[model samples]
Every structure is written in structure tokens, then in C-alpha cells.
Target: MDRSAEFGRWKAQSLSKADLSRKGSVDEDAVEVVELLNSREEFFTTSSCAGRILLLDGSTEGSGVQKQHCCWLLVTHKPCARDDVMAALKGATSEAVLKFEPFILHVQCRTLQDAQTLHSVAIDSGFRNSGITVGKRGKTMLAVRSTHGLEVPLTHKGKLMVTEEYIEFLLTIANQKMEENKRRIGRFYNYLQHALKRETISNSHSKIKERNNPLCTHKNRRSQGKAQGPSTTEDNGRELEDGDGLEISAALFLGDD
Candidate 1:
């Protein structure tokens, strides 16, 4: 199949699934990126999160060791307030933790080549931990992610380890991390768009070059002659049967298997 036809088939497959990022509870900052990816023929966003700050109640092991139960006390996609964090900490019976997670985005690609293109762009845009994997039924999935995260223990055995002033300081740091995460998201979108624009321009130049070059024309004519079943060499090259030449040219142009 030709590139256009293959792309059309892939697009139809992608449009069959609902984009979950459209739900109301999804992070507001990530909505635009999801929409951009869906608009492209090569990509479809499956699932995504815009990161969050959370309070957790878990247990502490020996020095510098703790096993979190992944329980959340309070979760916010945006920056949380000092009053909010303090209020959540008051009722902590075990160990308390304040965590900040960076943004994450998952995209399904039409091919492995497409997935690699996106992976390269993600890394250039500061998503250092981004990766590609083949999921169910051989679908190529691209995960856009960053390593900006924080996990700090706030209390132990129902007692506060840090002072109120220190809690405020930690909240300041978490807010800074939230801002950095948003910046990285913006970078990802900008870089991807720029790369796509370059590819389009490059493809245009390739087509123009292919049309103007005489060697390519001669080579195509030779292939057509062979398809026509033993044609004699002519002044330009070799004359080919009418229908056979067109068929041969199309197959060669499309790289059909």
C-alpha cells in the first residue's frame, strides 16, 4: 500500500477508541497536549495524568527506610496550600508523607517508527524517563514522563518530626516542582511541533528532487520495460507496453510489497 492509504488505515483504528483525557477530572494543563496528539494522523492519546501533590499515611522502617502503602490523604493536581497540608497531617496515626509527582502522558502510535520519533522528541523536551513499549496485540505505546518527584516523611508514630515552619518550606519546594513540571510539558509540545514541521518541509524537497532528476526517470523507464516482457532499447531507453509501464511505475513509487 501507498503511504497515504496505510496512514488512513491506521487513523481509522486510532479513532475507534475514546480519549480518556477529555473527562472532567483530568488535569487542566495536560488537556491541550492530548488534543494536539489526537489531531495528528500518526498518534492517539490513550491515558494521561498532569501530576499531583499528595499526603500519605504509611509505615517507617529502620533509618532512611520506609514502605509506603500507596494510600493518599489529600491529592491535588495544582499546588496545595500550607493550611491544607497541615490539616491532612493532624489526623495521621502512622507515618505521614508529602509527595509531588511529575506529569505523565501515554500515546499510541501507528508504527514502531512513529513511536521512536516521538520518544526522541520527548527526551529532547526534558522527559528524560520517557520510553516505548509494545503492548497488547503489538500496539506501540509511547510513555512521556519526567523524573521530577519528591517523597518526604512528615511524621512518625503519630508525632510530628518537623516544625510548622519546616512544613511551609517543604510546601514551597513542592510548588516550585509543580511549576517546573508545567514548563516541561510546554517544552514537549513546542519541540514536537517544530520537528514535525521540519519533516514536512524535508518531504516536500525530496518530492521536488525526485521529479526533476533525469537518472531517476531513466531507472523507472528500465523497470517498466522489464515488466512489459522483453522490449528493445530505444533512443531514450526502452519502450514499454502502455498499461504495464503505468502499473510498474506505481508499484515502484509506492514501495509495495
Candidate 2:
């Protein structure tokens, strides 16, 4: 099937399927972004997580432990309370680890351009680890993610490996990551809305301008902005950088996957 047809079929079937994530449905923090993307004709979300602070076991034994094999001692999308986490840790049968996983989203785009556009929004919004993967089956997926995650072993073989003071210290870091994750998600959603609207408005404006004045050319349009160009992008030749004010290398490809 053609890419568009394939994407359409996949989207329809996927959206109709039951929520398969561990939490059953989309997290409250991620619902808006997922709905926003699904509302767009060019994109649909496959899966998403708002971000979470996790306490799990069975993962400390292996280098790449699958989540399914691990026992989720505790999982919270919001900042975890010390008492709640301490209570959850009591059920730990083996090693227990505390972790903070940042927000992640998987979006299927109708075209490569759509994926790239979404990728830019993610990168600019501080999900620096975001990436695009084009499958052999003509599926273009963009994963919005970041590397600001934390994992620390709190217990070993059902025995406390660290002092309560240390656990509290760890929670402080994890909670900070959770707060930062919230900020990034907010930025991503806000920027994505603006970007999509800008694209549509720019396209419509170009068509209307051409239809209204067929003789108007690119040079004519360029001269029209010359008077107020100081505040426009035309004067920010060297000021443009990554959204986070970091020096983004031109050669940097937005992919860590």
C-alpha cells in the first residue's frame, strides 16, 4: 500500500485498539498532547507516557532488564512522597531501584516531512533525545524523549542497601527531574501548536497573496518587509540557535535511537 494509505489504515486500527500500556490509559499529563496530535490529519500517537517516578525490582540483576519482567514496586506520574515510596519498598522481594523516567511519546506521521516537522518541535522543546525512525514498511515514527532520567538501587536481595537519608536524597533528585519533565512537556505542546498553526497560516497566506496579485513576486514581497525588517527574522541572521539557547551543531542529526 502507499504510505498515506498505510498510515491511514494503521491509525484507524491502532486508535481502535485497547490501551495496552501498564497504566491502562494515557496519563493525565500526556492526554492533551496525545489528543492534539491525534486531531491532526497528518499524525497519530501510538503510545505515550507523561513521565514517572518508578520503584521496581528484578531489574537490578540484568544489564538490559525488560520492564515486563520487573516487579513495579511503585510507579507515580507525579512527584512521589517519601512515606508512599517507603511503604511500597516494603513489598520488594529482591533488589529495588528508584528511577525517574521522563515523558516519552511515539507518533506515526503520514510522511517523512511530517515526521521531520514533529522532530523539530520535540528538539526545540528540550526533548533533546527525540528521534525519527523510518521503518522498511514505509512507517515513519517520531519518538519524543529525553536523557534526563534517574535510576538508583535502594535495596539488594531484599535488604536495605542505603540509609533512609540516602533514599530521601535520591527522591529529591527524582522529583526535580519530574518537575523538569513537566516543563519540557509544556514547552513541547505549546511549541507544537504554534508550529502547526504557523505552517497552515503560511501556506494559506501564500496562496491568497498569489491569487490576489498574480504579478507579485518573491523580490516584491521581500522589499515590502524591508522597512520593519529590524525586528523580523531577516535581521537575526546569527541569533538563531536551538530553542534552549544552546549552540546546536548543523551536523547534529536529531536521533539517539
Where does model 2 exceed 4 Å of error?
62-68, 206-257
> Which residue runs of candidate 1 sit more than 4 Å off their true CA positions?
1-24, 59-69, 204-257
Put down candidate 1 lDDT per residue, 15-87, tens digits, no spaces. Answer: 6755544344446888878888888787877678888898988776555555545466788888888899889
TM-scores of all predicted structures? 0.69, 0.78
- Across residues 48-124, which tens digit of lDDT does each residue of candidate 2 receive? 99999999887444555444467888889988778888899899878888889999999999987677668777876
lDDT of residue 220 for candidate 1: 59
